[model samples]
Each structure stands twice: as structure tokens, then as C-alpha cells.
Target chain A: MKARLRNFLVALLALAGHLALTSPAAAATADPLPSWREGPARQAIVKFVQTATDRASAGFVPPAERIATFDNDGTLWTEHPMYTQLAFALDRIRELAPQHPEWKTQQPFKAVLDNDLEALAAGGEKGLLELVMASHAGMSTAEFEALVSDWFKKARHPRFKKPYTELTFQPMLELLAYLRSNGFKTYIVSGGGIEFMRPMTEAVYGIPPEQVIGSSIKTRYEMQEGKPVLTRLPEINFIDDKTGKPIGINTFIGRRPVAAFGNSDGDREMLEWTGAGKGARLMMLVLHDDAEREYAYGPANGLPDTKFGTFSQSTMDEAKQKGWIVISMKNDWQRVFSFQPETMNPAKK
Target chain B: MKARLRNFLVALLALAGHLALTSPAAAATADPLPSWREGPARQAIVKFVQTATDRASAGFVPPAERIATFDNDGTLWTEHPMYTQLAFALDRIRELAPQHPEWKTQQPFKAVLDNDLEALAAGGEKGLLELVMASHAGMSTAEFEALVSDWFKKARHPRFKKPYTELTFQPMLELLAYLRSNGFKTYIVSGGGIEFMRPMTEAVYGIPPEQVIGSSIKTRYEMQEGKPVLTRLPEINFIDDKTGKPIGINTFIGRRPVAAFGNSDGDREMLEWTGAGKGARLMMLVLHDDAEREYAYGPANGLPDTKFGTFSQSTMDEAKQKGWIVISMKNDWQRVFSFQPETMNPAKK
Candidate 1:
């Protein structure tokens, strides 16, 4: 029995060594955020996580309280050609155009159908709200989810010529996983429709639906033909942008985030709210300065101004003044999308 | 080296044997629900958990989909005489009476102050709303949380003559742990104030604030003295009762519950919605039939009717027709509160 135990122990040691050599955790520890180039922003995030997780450190945060919030649109994915949800809304409008012949003559609907971007912008918030109501609501939640899922399956980014999910910021994805591995509950606090995001967030971002807080339309529970359904209403219930981001975080998460990330003025309040929390804190804003690689229209750092995801000059000033790390797409990111050739797009490669 | 390895293996095996004997998991498996008597209801819960968790079982639910919802008030704790929230509201009226001199002359306030149950009941819904709004709103979120925490520290149940937190059903607590052990994520879906419940739910029920979905008043996000604060506003944002329960579950959880527990007609929609799910489902109602032990007011099994948590005869009929289990307080629960002497109260013992 003693001889057998000795042989078994030697074999176990050999197996332990083999497992250690192959473990992902061991490899992950070397460079958790490899997509992020060595920069102040990456250093800031790593330092915050280290201090917050270190048991002996004064800045240590309990795992239960290690909440981190991230904005979805410009922060996580490409919002350049227009927000993905807007793209979905436009496609939906065209798909349903035959059913509604009046849309051909309408302002926003006609703009979308005729591929007139300027006309859609001129119609403004009211036009956007109308489009959202028409496309996103008036169906059972399950049916709406199915529609969104089907759209995601087929819809491709106009510029990237790939699915919207493929356009996610690889550096941010790594950061999310890193925070999660460090015991932080990473949440998407977005201005996008809650129902629209819920269908795909888990698969694309690794953040579950319950963790994704966003703008929402009201839903009513009713029985139809002896079956229960939650019907999505056209009326807007909540807007999870600007000041609404903080409110949404408070309402859904019920905890203060120690770390926050956003790329535009819309996320200003959320950053402020998160920064106000005590102990180790990290807040970052992604700067779209790499115009050659990705569409750069921050209107901050002398980039061309665009209506979508406005990163104002004043917001940049605030980021500097408040000690919030500003990530330069040109400098901080080694790669933006997973589908992109390691360091550059195939055209550049 | 061989002798040392053999000795280490023998010691390791002995330590493992000792740990196995002493492990909480080993003891827990013996009887996960000691507070639940051997009955159809307890058996039903155990069987459902087993079938749902077993990977080989046809009714197996993935860990991610093992969502269980519970109603708070009468289902988790004693809700007789008046809801604990109602009691808190009345206490607040008295506490703030000197500041609000007009409250001395006000109908509901006067009724509360004078301890005239008849007059308070006569004032009805309007009176209750006035109490709720005045007591619940106008404070900053942090301040409100502090106030609630302070109240819970001192507040004692009128009947139990113990802290209200101590009045929580031990059987339910055990059941919650059991479900959690079986990989279920338990959430409290209640008609009570979200803020009121959030402060103590983590400590009391082992349910986090984010998992506690309840009715809430509107809150405004603002900068006060260069610090961000969310001020509670006196407008009803949501009422998570009846049909609203299903809507709340869908809106917050974004998934149908596999199991639901409640005690009243208000929870009918929640239970029904949960049961409508395709997989293994468990729907149960707590029938308060032990008047001698706990105040019985189901009005379900010919018990006395009450204003709060009215489990009507019609609801009982629906439960039967739907094949939902009705838990008898007299028979099903071996013990209620942890403070209640082992099997019975001192008088009965």
C-alpha cells in the first residue's frame, strides 16, 4: 500500500506540473489586457484592479462591492456609421416599408428608404423617437427579442462589412474579462434600448441581460387566449443617457461602481457618479483619434465633428482635470476589432 | 523520498476523511430543510430541485436558467395586523410629527398618532398613499438608506416582541439556501418599496439589493454641493403587484422564473407566469392555516379575511386547477421563525 501511494504521488506531481503548464489562468496573468497597448489608461485599470483585489491593501474592495460600469455604443462597439440600434431601426423601417406605403412620403422613413442621412438628422429626436416606437415596440417581448436576434444574425456593419457583434472593441472586451476575473461585476450601462441589447449582450459582451442596464419602453403583462405575455408599449419609459445613466445604474444595480468607462458626453454623469464612490477608482474615456483606422469624429482633439457620440472639447478638459484616463485609439489600442488583422485593417496590412 | 511521499499520502487521506465527516455539505445533505416537516409540500420542493439540477434528468434546467422568485411580505415574514412597511410609515408620521405641525390635524396622520385603527382604515387608499409619499420621498438615496438601516436597528414586531428581521420564516430561509445550493438564483419580487427592502434584504434574506425587485417612487439625479445625489421624488414609478409582478420580472430579470413562491392573490400573476414556462416548474402558495402558531388569514381554507395578503377562495380554486402546491403553515412548516422554540412556541411546548 505504501509503495503504491508513493508511485501515485509521483504521478500526481507530474500531472500537476502538466496542468500548470497548460492553465489559461497562468497565461492570462502575464497580460490580461494584451489588446490594450502599454499606456497610462491600461496601467490605470490594472493598478486599480490590483489595489482593489489585494487583501493587505488599504484600497481593497470586497468582491461583492467591486462593481464596474461600461457604456455600450462608442465605448464598447463602433457607433461611427451610426449606432447599431439606429442601423437596425433603419433596416426594420425598410423591411416594413411595403406594408406602410405612407412611409415612402414621410420625412424620416423616406430619408431611411432613400439612404438620405442628412434628412434623417434634420428630422432630429422626434423622428428618432417615431422610428424607435414603430420598430421596437407593439409586440410581445419574446417576439421583439426574436426580431432583434434575427436582425443581429443578418445585419452587417456598412463600413466593416461584418456583423455588428464583430465590431466590438477587443481591448474593452479583455478589460471586461479582466475585471470579472478580479471579482468585479461588469455591467453595460447604455443609452441603447434594453430589449434590443438583452438579446445579444450575453453572447457578444459576456455580460448577462440582468447586468445590462439601458433605456427601456414600458411593458404590460396580459393574458391572451389563456397564455401570458409581456407586451412592449410604444411609449418611452426611461432614457439611459447623460444623467439617466447614473439613475439607471442606481435603479438596476443598487450599488456604486468603483470603475466606469465611456467615450462621449452622454457618459459624463455616469463617470462622475462612479468617481464619487470611495476607495480605489478607475474611470476612462476612449478618444477616437485614430481616424485612419477607425472613423474619428470626437470633435475633441481637433477631430471632425459628427452628430453621433459627441466627445466635446469641454468633456476632454473635464477628463484631464478630474484625473479620468483618456484612451487614445491611435496610441492605447493595439487592435480595435477581433476580425481586424492583428495590428491593422487588411488594407493597411 | 518514497517513504516521505507514502507518509504524506496516508496523512492526506486521513485529513480528507476527517474533513468529509465534518463538512457542512455532508451534514446539509442529511436534511437541507429541517424547518420543513416531511409533507407533500416539502417533498415537492426537494423533488423539483433534484429533477431540475440532475444533468441526466429530462427536466434538467441549466444553472443560468434556474431562476426562483419569492414574494416578500406574508410569504417570508409575518404580515398580520399591518404590513411591516405600513407600521414603519406610521412610526415615521409620529417621529416627524413635531416638525410637521399640520400632521396633528391631518386625518391619516391624526389617525396614526392617535392609534385609531378604525379611522386609519376609513381613510383608505388615499390616506395610505399620503403616508407612503410623505414618509418615503424627498430624501437623498444615501440618506434614505441610512434612515431605513437606523429604523431596522430599533424596530420590533408588535406581536413577536422581537426585531422584525427575527420574524423571518426559518423554513423559507432554509428553502432559499437549499435552492441556492442546487444552483438557483433566488430573487424577491415584492409589492413593497424597493428602497425600503434594499437596505436589509442582503442581511435578512441573503438576497442582494439588485435581486430585490419591488415597487419604487421616482428619483431625480442631481449635483448637491458638488456631489452627486439621487433624491427620492413623491411620484409612483411602479407598483409591483398583480399583473405588474410579471412585467417587473420580465423587465428586470429578462427571464421567466422556473419556480415561484407567494401567499396572496397579488402574487397570482407571478405564479401563473412562472408556471407557464416550458421546463420543470414549481408554483406554491403559503397557506396560513395555523392561527394558534401564526395569525391565520388566508380566507382560502375558510380562514378569517384580512386587508393585507388576502389569499382568497377563488385563488385557492385556481391553484388547485393549475396544480399548484398550497403549503399548510400548520402542517408543512415544522418551525416558523428561528426564535420560535424548536418545534413549537413556549406556550404550546
Candidate 2:
């Protein structure tokens, strides 16, 4: 009887030790999306990845065909107060104001100089293009890359006060890593300038330059002082937004993505294109509904409509009709940015 | 004494078995470029790859930055008897001739139908664009891919009497595989239409569609019968030749290539741009000097210059001055094509 009791006790201890070793690892594997709250949005992503990766599943996608595209601006990071690229352009104009004394009297340049965003907005697309050309062009690609890199090193967001790179969504970053781990190639199909995004994409999003498709201005190859240089020109080459999104994806990737994530009306066509593919696919839109953590400006719940990343009612309707997942920032995420608010040291105004 | 002899025999047998198993594997690793004969061209390639991959070497490049670009036509495959794409276009025009009655009288169309090369050359770039649009555009990207794939399956070269896809350079194919084995990404940066090359690149060159950078026509995205389709437009979007080569590389790849290979003046800017980068770089030009195996039409050795892939005297001079390795087809290649002449079964005339 004593031998039986001792054996039972030993078996119990062995079982406990095995559980201890495997529990954490099992938990990690089970909940790949820890930042995502237990909701429909997270469930859909998990299910799609599971089905696509399972060899026996009807929706099994080969690794080569497992392409996932994400929009950059509001989907990946903060595009509030203004677009990060626009902010860069404004700052660039200010930096060059000293070079052109006429900028002190010029309408759009003066508006930017005085921090008058309303007037700058009133100047419209033409005014914005002028600012982009003046700031983004006239330098070799190498020089422009350095200039953008230097700016990113010092620039801080107006509201969050964090460096722009730090403002990337923690949940999205986790999602990117998770997808990549599951043999899905993640690409950034953004409306931002290709050169502007290529410099920092690898470091920030773990996405290489070749995987990024974005807007671009023309660049010319020439021999300057017996050395080859790619000089950036002021003319616009391609805009990767709205209808252009699908076209750009076809042009660059030459493959239809199985899944797509975006935050605005600009992403509607891309999502539709992805959903139209004949397979189990995922389409997600991140709704900015948390006023405390991030700016809320979607056309949802009487939120003010903003031009930065316009999430229109029609887009919401389309998502509903197509059964696309609408990810609520307030209800779905356990965290927003990577760093805690207290840790962010805002630059002096 | 009998036991001792048995032991010695077992040991000798074990040594012989081990040598037999490892010999082929060791040879494969030692000589990555088996098709490339012992010459400066092969030496340059072997040296560059070794230095770039060696972690202890000063010229060590990370796996991500080891990008190698190659021109498609004359460099990777035969461009003589006109470009492969041009032949495909002519066949397509003939196939569609029965449908269009007006084409029977059209100048370029008549020239194509009658097999008049002189008249087709007189029609020039504008006429080529017309043929391309008629044959390549108006169809969906998927449909175009199927068309090209079907054509490649049946089409045969006039001189080689083999399928055009089978005419790919054996040495370059070996080079591509070697580069890929050493952690380098091989990309086809060609002047051919992006769509035309994509179908065959993967099957013939082991390059996926996304890695191909080439000329393109404008495509529009639209929902037809509730399904999204990208329709190729009858307009030129961008060209990928000469100065355009560098631009295309920048636009699609967003990274400067560490190594570049080409066969004509059209590749001058791409090689120059690649060589201008910091650290060790390699630029090579394939000089077509073998008349028996491949047509010789360069300015070298008093050969007749053809418009297809013109290697002018100035280009040769520049290549010499820049220290770009010139590969002589006759001397540097042990084999030209994957298939021997005896195996080819030409299509019915």
C-alpha cells in the first residue's frame, strides 16, 4: 500500500512538471495575437491564417500565393493632426524658406510658414503638389534619402509628441510579424512616396524596399562630374490611391494579394480587389474610435470628417455588405503605440 | 591472423564508401559555374560572389543587399532573327489577321503578313508600338499571361529549330542558380514588356514575376459583372531601356543592384549606376562573337551592326575604360543552350 501511494505521488509530480514546461509555449502559440482583444476581428484573422496554412483545409494557400498588403498612413501608424509626409513637406518648406526670400510673400509658402493649415488646405491639391515638388525634388536619390532620414531622426508628432517612427501601431506590428511567421509575405501598398517609405520601412515594419509599392515622382539617370546619379524630378510619376491602388499592386507585385488591410476610403478598391479573388480571403479596416489614445475622425458615431484619412459612410456600408472586418481601436486593442505615454519625452515647442 | 586481415578489409571498405558519397557534393560546391569556362569573365563572377559572401572579407555584403540584375534578350537568351517578343508579336498578328480585314492593307500589318523585314524596320518604333497594342493590350492580365504561356509552349526558333524557351543560355542559367544558392536575389531588368517576360521568366529563368522590372502599358482596374479585372490599355506607361533601365530599377526594386549584366548599349546606364555605388561592384557585358553557335552582329571584328541589340564601338570603348568584364561567347561558354542541336524538333513551317 505504501509503494502504491508513493508511485501515485511521483506520477502527479511528473505531470505537474510537464504542464509547467509546455503551458507558456502552448499559450503563446494559441494566442498569436495577444494585443487583440477576444473579438470577431481577431477571430477572423486567426481563422483565415489557420485555414490558409492548413494543408487539409479547403482554403489552403501555398506560401508563394500567400500575399498580404497593408496601407501605411492611418492603418500602420498615426496620420492624425496631418499626414506624416505632409508634416515632413511643411517642415521642409520652412527649412528652405531661408534660401528663397520670396517665400516670405508667397501665398502657400507663407501659409505653411505661419502654421496656417486652413489656408494651405484651401490652396488644394495644386498647392500641395507645389510644396512637394519644391521640397522633394532637385536632389539626387541618395541626397534625398539622407535628407529624409535626417528629418525622421528629429521630427516629433504634434499631439503624441513621440518620434514619428515610434507612433506605429503596436497591434499592427504584431500582426505583420505574425503573418510573416505564417509564410505570408507582407507588403505595404501605400499612397505615400515610394522613396520616402523605402528608407525606413525595413527598420520600422520589417518590410524590405522591394515589398513596398507607393506613389513616386519621376527620377532621371545622368552622369554628374563623371559619376552616375539618379536625380529626382518635380513631375509626378504615379499616385497609388483609390483606383490607383489596384493598378499599382498589379504593376509592382504582379500578383493579387490574398488579404488586405487599410483604414480609409483610399483602400476601398484594394479591399474589393482582394475579396474578389476566388478563395478564403481577409479584408480589414482599422476604425479610429478612441479619442483618448488616438484621434477619432471616422464618419462613425457623429465623429468629425477629416481630409487626412477620410473613412466615409459609403466605405463603412461597403465593408458591411462585403463582410469585411472593421477593427475598432477602442474595443479591439489592448495597446496602441509601442511605448507608454509617460516614456515619450516631447520636444520643446 | 585471419581476424586481423578481416578488420583491415572492413576499414578500407568504409573509407571507399565515404569517398563515393561525398565526391559529387564536394565537386558541386567547389565549382558553382561549371558551364563557364576558365576565363576572365568567369573569374570576375566567381571572385565577386566570393568576396561579397565572405563575412571576414572587407567587401562582404549582407544577404539582403546582394541583388544581381540581368538584361533578358541578348544577355540571357538569343535576340538574333529579331527579339523573341517581336517574333511572338508577328505570330499573334498572323493569328488575328483573319479577324481584321483592314490589317491586310495596313503598311506595318502588310509588312508583318508578307514577312518583309526591311519594310517592318522602316515602320520603326511607332509601328512596333502599334503591333504591341494590337496583340498585347485590350485583354485582361490573366488572359494575356495564358496567351503568352500557350505561345511559348508551341513556338520554335527558325535557326535553332528549338522552342524559344529552350534557347536560354545554359551558362547564365547556371549563373542565376549559383547566385541564388549564395543568398543573392536575381532579378530580370529587361527592356521587354513586363507581361510578356513574366509568363516565361519563372519557368525558364527561375525568376518570379515580382522580381522582373520591365517596360509596361497602363492598366485600369474595374469591376466587370461584379468581378474585378485589370484591363491593359493601349498606351505606354514606361519604358525600361538605356536611361530608362536605371529608372525602372529604382522604381521597382528601390535598391541599387550590386551586380549587373547586359549585352548592348541599352544597359550602359544600369551598369554605370551599379558601379557608382560604394563597396565592391561587378559589371559585365556579353560580347556575341560566335557565328556558328550564335549570330555575331556587334561592331567588334567588322561584324554587321543590326538594330535589334546594337553593341556599338563606343559602348565597347566605354566597357574597356570602365573595366567591365567582356564575356566572349565562343571562348567562355562550354555550352550555349540547355538542349543540344540533335534534340530539337522544329515546328512545321
Tell me how far the alpha carbon of residue B110 in candidate 1 is from the true structure, in angstroms, after superposition: 1.6
DockQ by candidate, in order: 0.41, 0.27
Residue B148 CA displacement from its true place in model 1, Å: 0.4
- Model 1 off-target regions past 4 Å? A1-29, A345-349, B1-28, B345-349
Candidate 2 per-residue lDDT over residues B124-222, each given as its tens digit: 999999999999998999999999999999999999888999889889999999999989999999999999998888889999889999999999998
Measured by TM-score, the strongest candidate is: 1
The residue pairs found clashing in candidate 2 are none
Local distance difference test values of all predictions, in order: 0.88, 0.88
Residue-wise C-alpha lDDT for candidate 1, range B15-99, written one tens digit per residue? 5555556666554556889888788999899899989998999899999899999999999988977898998888888998999
Please give, for residues A231-299, the per-residue lDDT of candidate 2 as tens digits: 999999999999999999988988899999999999999999999887779999999987777878978
Interface RMSD of 2: 16.2
